[model samples]
Target: MDLNVTLVLIGVDIPRSGLLRSGYPDPRTGQWVFSPAKTAKSFNPSAVTQTERRFDLVDLAPFDYDSAEGMTAFVQHLAGIEGRLRLLRARPGMLTEGEMPEYLFRRTHGIVGLLKRLIEDGCTEAMESGAEELTPELLSTIQINLGNLDDRDPTAGEIPEVPHNVPVPARKARKKDRNSVFDDRGGSVAGG
Candidate 1:
């Protein structure tokens, strides 16, 4: 906690502009903020679609860079991906701007999985970029935001307690050599 390792991070927003993009709307807030918003353009296979869209904010918080595979994927992306590679691309404004770009690519197309992967990628890149303080806090926030969609664990809300009186085993203390002093060495020639 005391070490001063400065880490740089970038926040990313996936482009939600294609017809195929799908996600749940913000349930409590009743907004399309976090969800993917696909443009409902008249069924046009003819028109070109911008693969990536911008997001709200990006944070480059201090963090510990962990995970090799994650860093690899991020490096690959930075090196350049096949299709539209949408991401925050790292800047101080990312944290303040509150928006990111999303890209539509043919491969790696599982919506939910891909999004999670992208976030993971962002964190990896951030760490590689020398961000020490921002990564953890930023990543934690991203998780908290996205965790909204996940169903809460049923056990988490419940209170825990000790069950019925299953008896605990007892340990015995060793008795001291109390009778040792009373025994005369049996050599009574001089003292007798």
Candidate 2:
């Protein structure tokens, strides 16, 4: 048998629209009919309405995963953030502006502008250096590291030779002009 003392100690917060066991008499039968007892109407509405609050925490749920793609994307995002932060927190000496022959006074103006331009120049230089280092071998190595350079794939085989004698489809070449409008059927659309 269930004990009543244990159940009584736990005060259950049941949402009651009216008093429990409350009833009304049937009009025709004169029998007592019961319904869920709703609490007496209050000055307040049923639901509490308030302004939406902002969640301060960063949502990293999408980046948190056991999958290789998710991990790679997360790592790439971190790397990008690191790069940007490094640039943002860079010292004036790190940029080429320090090498400039101009001497600054104690109350020099436009120093912030000079620093901004120097940072831009440094970013351009870094981009140029990265572009110069890009090669097919580096790309192949990256692909290999990512487990994408599979030799077993048919399309990944040696490049096929192109045939000199091939029939080209006879179709009118459409001109891509800013003022021109073309529809899906290759017909000129009537509009500005």
Candidate 3:
């Protein structure tokens, strides 16, 4: 019996100190070179030897937290405001309207995960308090867990100014561009 197997590993902010144990400055090129016993004692050398290929994927573009339209769209999507069923029953002039988006940006420091939690908690609080809409006073009562990633101190910067009367552009809607080679005789898609 014969078998072909491939394994791929993906990680973020992986620490390289353990892999490159010790290095001395090269006398010829004045560059640091790993010593013969570079691998840490805990790391199995066989694993490194077995790794046929290593690829570092390019980082994706960061979210435009500064864009009022983008942030509003994100909040609306999370709250199901644009959908048939609403996750948060925000008052008419709140959330996607007025200064709520700016206020939320300040509170969450523009972090999407944190913003989601904040809105979810605010919704729960509103429901419990019998409030019709989310208010600054009501949301202030809800505590957000920042964890280790963000500082408890308020983010230092002026909130991005939102343009008035400017319509938020709709997301581009287009059919996926497919290769003509995949089309069958009946003009239907065939398995690649």
The candidate that wins on lDDT is: 3
What is candidate 3's lDDT per residue for 1-192, written digit by digit as tens? Answer: 324555454332222324333445566765545434436565685454332213322222223566777765656654454243243564444665555666666676555556667777877777887884576667677777545644323332112222223223333578998889865567656684
TM-score of predicted structure 3: 0.41
Give the per-residue Cα lDDT of candidate 3 at 86: 41
Clashes of each: 31, 6, 0
TM-score of 2: 0.19
In Å, residue 188's CA in model 2 sits off its true spot by 65
Q: Give the Cα error of residue 76 in candidate 1, in Å.
A: 42
C-alpha TM-score for every candidate: 0.18, 0.19, 0.41
**Candidate 3 whole-model C-alpha lDDT, 0 to 1:** 0.52
lDDT of 2 by residue, 1-192 (tens): 434442222111111222224345566765545543345566653222211111111111224335667545544543443345343334433211221212111111213323233334444454555642212222222211112334433343222221222222233568786843554666676894
Question: How far is each candidate from the true structure, as Cα RMSD in Å?
Answer: 22.3, 28.2, 18.3
Query: Candidate 1 at 34: error in angstroms?
Result: 17
Best by TM-score: 3
Candidate 3 residues lying further than 4 Å off, grouped into runs, are 1-62, 67-94, 146-192
